[model samples]
Target: MSAPYVLVLYYSRHGATAEMARQIARGVEQAGLEARLRTVPAVSAECETVAPAIPEHGAIYATLDDLKHCSGLALGSPTRFGNMAAPLKYFLDGTSGLWLTGELVGKPAGVFTSTSSLHGGQETTLLSMLLPLLHHGMLLLGLPYSQNALLETRGGGTPYGPSHHAGADGKRALDEHEISLCRALGQRLAETAKRLENNRG
Candidate 1:
């Protein structure tokens, strides 16, 4: 059997969300699991428009197989009108096959988001991401109050998941608290997955 891995899947527009994904991946590796970073191509309104097979930079596009084989998942996206970005949703909408087969059942999952403003729907975006994962029967993981960053964060941190406030220009770097929360969520998912796998064994 292949080694267990956590899929850190995301859609990044201004790059803040992508940085969060990297921090989450770092935490996943800290907990001794592989982190497979993947991103979705942008969606265009025009039906004929298609993204290139290979992205110009950042993570490669995600495949259904990536979602299928992941031992755990950390989903991230920038907030778009209090919701996850269309690209991430579009990619997830294509996952009906996994849902039908229950391929993701019992796996641990978490969500994160970045927003242009502090009140730019960070929590709502995270919640939006979780809905589809719930339908897949995955065990949802959130940051517990025990994490100091959740309480101390001035930029973005939530019980729903990690969050970042990128400022109106979308250039503000993630604060220490936000980064800590992101790493915390990743570690939590990895540890929970390990426990679940051991139980099955």
Candidate 2:
């Protein structure tokens, strides 16, 4: 059997969400699991703009098999009008095969997002990411008030998941609170998945 791992899948436009994914992956590894970071190609209106088989930088493209076999999941995306970016949505929309076969059932999952403004629908975007996971029968995980950062964050921490305020130009780095919450969410998801795996054993 393959070794268990957590998949940190995200679509980052200007790098903030990607940085969050890295922090979350750090937490996953801190919990003693492999963190597999993957990303999707951007979708274009033209429908003919195809991305290369491999990205020039950052994490490699994600395959359905990665999602299917992951012991846990940390999903992230940038906010688009209070929703997840279209590329991430498009990726999830193509996962009906996994849904149909129940490949992701019982896996622990969490969501994260980066928004251009403090009130730029961070929570809503996180919630939007959860819908597909729910349909896959995956167990949802979130940051608890016990994390402290969630309670004190002035930028982008939520009970739904971790978030970031990327500023109007999308260049703002994640603040300390946001990073802590991202790591917390990842650790929580990894620990939960480990416990669940043990139960299954």
Which candidate gets the maximum lDDT versus the true structure? Answer: 1
* Least well predicted 10-residue stretch by lDDT in candidate 2: 44-53
lDDT of 2: 0.93
Name the regions of candidate 2 deviating beyond 4 angstroms.
none
TM-score of each: 0.98, 0.98
Model 2 C-alpha RMSD to native: 0.9
lDDT of 1: 0.94
C-alpha RMSD between model 1 and the true structure: 1.0
Model 1: what TM-score? Answer: 0.98
Q: Write the per-residue lDDT of candidate 2 for residues 1-201, one digit (tens) a residue.
A: 788899999999999999999999999989888899999998887893367878999999999999999999999999999999988888999999999999999999999999999999998899999999999999999988899998888888999999999999999889999999999988988899899999999
Per-residue lDDT, model 1, residue 127, is 95
Error of 1 at 145 (Å): 0.8
Model 1, span 100-145: residue lDDT tens? 9999999999999999999999888999999999999999999999
